[model samples]
Target chain A: MYAFEYFAPKNLQEATKAFNSFNDSKWLAGGMTLIPSMKLRMNAPSALIDLSSIEQLKGISIKNNILSIGAMTIHADVANSLDVINSLPALASLASGIGDPQVRNRGTIGGSIANNDPAADYPSAILGLKSKIITSKKEIDAGNFFNGFFSTSLDTDELIVKINFQIPESAIYLKFANPVSRYAIVGIFLSKYHDEVRVAVTGAASCVFRVNELEEGLFHDFCSSVVDKTDYGITNLNDDIHANSEYRRYLIKVMIKKAISILQKK
Target chain B: MRISLTINGNPVSEDVDNRTLLADFIRNTLGLTGTHVGCDTSQCGCCVVHLNGEAIKSCTMLAVAANNSEITTIEGLSNSEDLSAMQESFRRNHALQCGYCTPGVIMSAVDLLKNNPKPTEEEVRDALEGNLCRCTGYHNIIKAILDVSKAG
Candidate 1:
């Protein structure tokens, strides 16, 4: 890793000031991804603004059918939190399925969403649950959050404060994890709400995306039979040594079917 | 950069370069070599340590970020009286052969049990999915964690 100045601000104001003044400064959330990228010389920043010490960026709160999670909330916290598990079991289950125990404990929801890794599991839930990301600047809808590849709509000076999710009637996240990396090769999130249903797919494309066809089918008939009869074209999904684009396309269908089946059984 | 944290029940302060990782701070600066760095990426859990009583890959964390945080490495799990329950289970069940991945495995196991003490065998396997081991097929390690949980 290259030499850089490190600043640990106790409050968000001080952190935001340091972040704005420092050239090429990167906010250190959980370091699950950034630290490794730095060690591999894949990234070089002039300064590191540590958000871990900033007390405001850590917790989970639920009220009025809305779950508000601090951006820095760790995966383990979400997986183990009673409020999350009881109110939003699908989200809790999704958090429990991320990486391994160690990764879950340290990796932050904010970091994962901010990085917007295509193979990440959180985006599927965020998109399917119609979550709202509250940043220092403005709130962004989950639909417009992800840009493409590893990109997002966030600007350089902005910091994500919290992510809010409205509790759906029923939701399930199904993932086919790559055995080696533990990343989702293909995952689907099925969220059923009043008169609306969202089907989001991850690990099958350059970014997590919603399956409009499946969404339409569920909109017409909110049942497994509806999704089972739906067709999703495999136009431009991800392809790698782990699985080919065709295989990933197949896995996406399978995951969507499985997620719907699970949701139906629930 | 100057960073201070309570590690393995000991408070230590050190001046370091901003690029120093929490893994290096624990191993090189504090001279606690038990925490090994495998991939230096979050991909490997060999450098896993407890930050505020939760297991996390130390290699991925910056040293300055851990300042004022309480950390527990594998070294802090036992005493002269006897090894911790998880450590003893690992030995009795032969959970490790080369022993390079034991510290991390034990750290993760302690964390798993702390949260879900009565985990089923499948849950145990699921909990260890992040910490990779090439030598063992994870049969004995899974058994070790279950045994400790059962005993406790």
Candidate 2:
């Protein structure tokens, strides 16, 4: 890592100030991805505005039928939160399955979505549950937040405060995780709110995306049979060493089936 | 930058580079060699340490970020007189071969047991995913953690 000025801001205002004043500054959330990238010399920022000290950006709460999670809340905390587990066990389970215990202990939900790694799990949850991303400036719907692979609609100075997820009637996340890195080979999150059905797939594309065919099939008839009948085309899917595009398309159907089966039993 | 923290119950202060990793600060600056750095890519858990009571990979964290926080390394697990229960269990179960990954494995296991006192074998295995052990094939290490849980 290159030598840089580090500032641990106690509040969002100070963080924003540091970010605006610095030449090439980056907001350090959990530093799980940023530090590693810096160490690898892939990213070299002039200043690091650490947000760990900002008390306002750390918590989990539920109000108005929305599950609000602070941006800086570590994955371990989200995984073990009683409120999250009770209100949305699928989200808790998703947090718990990210990486390992050590990774969960340090990685934050905000950092995960901010980085917007194509293989990350949070984007799938955000899109599938139709969460609202509450930033320092405005609340962006999860559908509109993600732009493309490793990209988001967030401005450089715009800090994500928290994310608000509406509790779905039934939702579940299933992923075919890479054994070594534990990133998803093809992860799918399926959620049903009354007659509305949403299917978000991650790790099998350049960005987290929704499968309209499966969503429409499930919307018409919410069952494993409906998902099994749908054919998810391999066009525009990610083809990597872990899995080819055709294999990813197949896994998407399998994962959606698994999630539907799990939701059906719930 | 100058930073201060409580390490192994001792209050210490040091000046380090802004990019200094916590593992390097612990092993090089502080001379606490018990915390090993097997792989610096953050995949290997050889540098696992307790930061504010949570087991995190020290290599992935900047030393300055840990300022004002409470850290517990492998050396803090035991005094000069005797070894910690988890360490003792590893010794009794022959869970170590070259001992390169033992300190981190023990540190991770101790944290797991702290959270879930009586974790099952599968649970222990799942928790140990971050900590890699090539020599023992993980059979004895899993048994050692289970033995410690059963003994408690």
Candidate 3:
């Protein structure tokens, strides 16, 4: 990693002020991803605005049926939170399974979603539950927040403050993970609301996406067998040596069945 | 930049380049060579250390980011030549062959027991997924961790 300026701001206003002065700076969330990227020379920045010390961007809270998690909250904190376990156990379970214990100790939800790796576990939850991303600038719907690939609707200067979710009636996330990295080979997040059902898929494409067919089928039947009748999209998958596109497409149906089965048992 | 932090219960302050990883600061600057750097890419947890009481990959975390933080490395696990409880279990269970990944594996095992003193066999394996040992195949390592948990 090349030498660069480091700034630890006290608050949001100070952090943004520091960011604006440096044309090529990145926000240091957990640095679970960014620091590794720097060491690999995949990224180099003029400076890093550390967000760890900011009080406002660190916690999990439940209020008025909305579960709000501050952006800088680490994965381990979320996984062990009594608030999360009581409100949404599936989400807590998903948090517990990300990377490993060490990775979870330092990795943050803001960093994960902002990076938006196609195989990441958080985006599937974000999209499936339709969480709102509250940025330093404005609040954006989960549907509009993700663009494609590693891209997001966020401007360079925009910093994510917190993520907001409505406590679903029931939600479950199932992932077929890579043996080594533990990244999702194919993940299915099934969320059932009062009026409609959502089916989100990750690692099957360039970005996390909702399967309208699967969603519709589940809406009608809301059972494990719904995967049989649902015709999910399989084009433009984020395929690699770990798993090919054809294999990934097949795993989608397999995971959906598994997820629905587990959710049904609940 | 100069940062202040405590390692193994002692306070230390040092001036370093911003590019310095926490692993380098411990191994290179402080001469605490116990923490190994097997895969600097963060896939291997050779550099796992406790940052403010939570284990994290030190090679991937900037030293500056760990400023004002409490760190516990392999050396920190014991003050004298005596091995810690987890280290003793690893030795009694014959959990290593090359011993290259010992410091990290021991550090990670201790962390697991601290958080969950009596983890199930599956839970023990899940906790140590990041720390890889090419030699042991992880059977005896799992046994070693469960041994400590059972002893208590």
Give fnat for candidates 1, 2 and onward, in order.
Answer: 0.97, 0.87, 1.00
Q: What DockQ does candidate 3 have relative to the true complex?
A: 0.91
| Full-model lDDT, candidate 2 | 0.93
Enumerate residue pairs that collide in model 2.
none
Instruction: Specify the highest-lDDT model's number.
Output: 2
Candidate 2, TM-score vs. the true structure? 0.98
Tens digit of lDDT per residue, candidate 1, span A1-266?
88888887888889989998877998888777888788888989998888877778889999899999999999988988999999889999999888888778778999999999999999888899979999988999999999999999999878999999999998988889988777899888889888788999899889999988879777777666765576656588777888999898777776777777777787
Query: How high is the TM-score of chain A in each model?
Result: 0.97, 0.97, 0.97
Which numbered prediction scores highest in TM-score against the true structure?
Answer: 2
| Candidate 2 backbone overlaps, count | 0
Displacement of residue A217 (Cα, Å) in model 2 is 2.4
| Overall local distance difference test of candidate 3 | 0.90
What's the best-to-worst order under TM-score? 2, 3, 1
* Tens digits of per-residue lDDT for model 3, A99-159: 9999999899999999999889999999999589999999999999889999999999899
Comparing to the true complex, what docking class would candidate 1 get? high
Deviating ranges (above 4 Å) for candidate 2: A231-234
| Cα error, candidate 2, residue A46 (Å) | 0.3
Weakest 10 consecutive residues of candidate 2 chain A by summed lDDT:
A226-235
